[model samples]
Target: MVVLRTGPVAVGGVTLGNHLILAAGVLGTTGASLSRMLARGAGGVVTKSIGPEPKNGHAGPCVAVLDNGILNAMGLPNPSQDFTGELGSLGQKPVIVSIFGGTPEEFAEVAGWFKGTAAGFELNLSCPHAEGYGAAIGVDPVLVEACTRAVSTLGMPTWVKLTPNVTDITAIGKAAERGGATAIVAINTVKAMRISTALRRPVLGNRYGGLSGDAIFPVAVRCVYELFESCKIPIIGCGGVSTADKVVEMMMAGAQAVEIGSAVQRDIGIFETITNELYAKKGIEPGEIVGCAHE
Candidate 1:
């Protein structure tokens, strides 16, 4: 299959085969996994979030399955320096490297590893489970802007992933815009946890985790709608988007693209399914419906 299939998508100065991108942290741990998703019909893929150093992440029981969604606290584990080798197999593919750091300098340092190699960068400013990085630095507008600006200066299409744990997501979205971000990825998993009744303790080993799946779809839509109203940059809607209908709904809410994570866990061929379903249901392009709800 072609690595970069021509399409109508041009979000954040990046061209993709389609609007359905594989979200970070799912089947993105290696070059093979990333390429598998692309072969399965995903427009592109975001690698699992990497950092300045290798991280083993938290203890066991990192994931808890709920009726409505999945709660996970993966802690953003990655090989860090070793991640560069994984990219050799993905040459010319629209692969955006997801990165995180505790500070602006660290963020810049991590992103610099992929300079001229990655199609773009998705700053992990929104991961709720990661303490020093992720939401810890993302909740504040100042840090978001600083981290974004640091990476933006490297001359790559930078997309800041925002956390929904905050009261106002648009504030952070605007901050990314002010920092010269090419696009804003709205609503990472919602901060949440589940208590085990039989064990009488938290289900996750981390005690807290971010919730994602069908349940958070509405929350994601709301965040995208809000961010659309405030930020001029392209918006990538992420969170429980699983179906063709959800993709359209996300676009209507102002998302130029959508990321599928939990659904991919259920079915690796989901991208192909949604692509056929989307084309069948009127063959609408991504640009035509983005922010349609505003009208």
Candidate 2:
């Protein structure tokens, strides 16, 4: 076992072995996949957003690789089974289950199903392309607060993932905090689309998709900084994080921990690589750099 000495960072009171979290909706579906990421040095894993029932997601051609980033409209697909069994098998690694629903009650019900199985819950309130869920619920502060309050009752730490599509993300972040969220994951993918020049139609099956990767890193950093200023809760930055320098940048931008999703597709070994680079180049731990930019 190549134990990474990257030090510890906490989010929503769950103490992670390190600050590198496998972003939700990435390579974290089955227990085997989760274990694989852990073995590769991910400090924790966030499962794909699972709803009350199984979701087939969008149709064909759901993902597109762009010059600057990746566009995806997966529609939050997942097996509609109780994932507690799979979560329980992951041993001591912190597993943060990401969930979504159309209403606060529904969100609570889905969270209840995973009650003793996960270290925390990340409310997938900001998936831009999912209808009747995700950004639709996340864009409204009232709904955001209601969902946060409902899920917080599950007796596990709850982190609300907010959307950058709103005029002021901090408003949503504040609402999440007000509703008892333990932490806030700032900035989900941005709403975007790509038109196929050859086909003369939208490339994504959903017609619209969320843009991720290096294209949104600056936006994510800004959201984290603003949310940290307005809310007292810890912030988990998620956007276009791909390198150790970007990780440090996010920490300086007030993110206690950072999530890398699309970047993992480009390099599965990114976790170990970033941690090693952080330690070797700066002699600084992620925990040591949290909010350093504000000082």
Candidate 3:
């Protein structure tokens, strides 16, 4: 694959090859996969969310494809500390480890395991379907701050992923900032569900899942816009971001960088494609457009 360059971007204290990052859980399960994304075009890659223990994730039918997006209740399946071995060949590529846990101590312990190997840590405080974790603890401002503090204290570039399921996303963004986060990732998947008309039951095994992809792009932009107004920290925008136009729009809404997930399922070369288009249409650096809409 030809290396597509759109100039480097610095977010959450780390320099990226470009502004396009592979969101957590999209081909992020293995070190080889994460490295592959970077090799293909992503400026950075976030490993799938890891917890305190190994998990099998949700049962069958955990993912349901939609016309506009994807709904999944994978339950945060991960190998925990055992996954560390896969990082051996990743080299110095910008690999951000995505982690989650039930408490501050748990979150800190999980981050501690890979502090030496990862370029940074993206706290997965926004997984909506997982029980006793993710949105379960993420919705509260107090816990969000505590969890962020627990991991931020580790001295790594800490980026906190926020849930859009909340009443006020800026509140959580502020909490993450108050906890000393290096940056804040806005707008995780929206909480949603689908009933199988033919099967006469819920499509997802968990009866609920997080909705991601084009459907949530507007919501993600709104959240980023709000965070940019309310917080002083850099914001990494996620949710429904796919095209180069969308990336530009997101940055205009206040995101310094953008993460793409579900869109990759359709085209694995999305990062390179987007970067090419981005530079083709807009010759200037991405930073110049950050929050341009606000002006």
Ten consecutive residues with minimal summed lDDT in candidate 1? 1-10
**Clashing residue pairs in candidate 2 (N, C-alpha, C atoms within 3 angstroms):** none
Q: What is the lDDT, from 0 to 100, of the residue 226 in candidate 3?
A: 94
Model 2 regions lying over 4 Å from their true place: 1-5, 280-282, 285-288
- lDDT, candidate 1, at 184: 92
Which runs of model 3 end up more than 4 angstroms from their true locations?
Answer: 1-5, 280-282
In order of lDDT, best first, we have 3, 1, 2
Predicted candidate 2 versus true structure: per-residue lDDT over 110-219, tens digit per residue: 89888777788999999999889999999999999999999997678999999999999989999999999999997799999989899999999899999999999999
lDDT of 3 by residue, 5-66 (tens): 35778999888988899999999989889988998899999999999999999997999999
lDDT of 3: 0.91
Relative to the true structure, how large is the alpha-carbon lDDT of every model? Answer: 0.90, 0.87, 0.91
Candidate that beats the other on TM-score, 1 or 2, i.e. the better one: 1
- RMSD of each predicted structure: 3.2, 2.8, 2.6
lDDT score, residue 115, model 2? Answer: 77
The residue ranges of model 1 lying beyond 4 angstroms of the native Cα positions read 1-8, 280-282
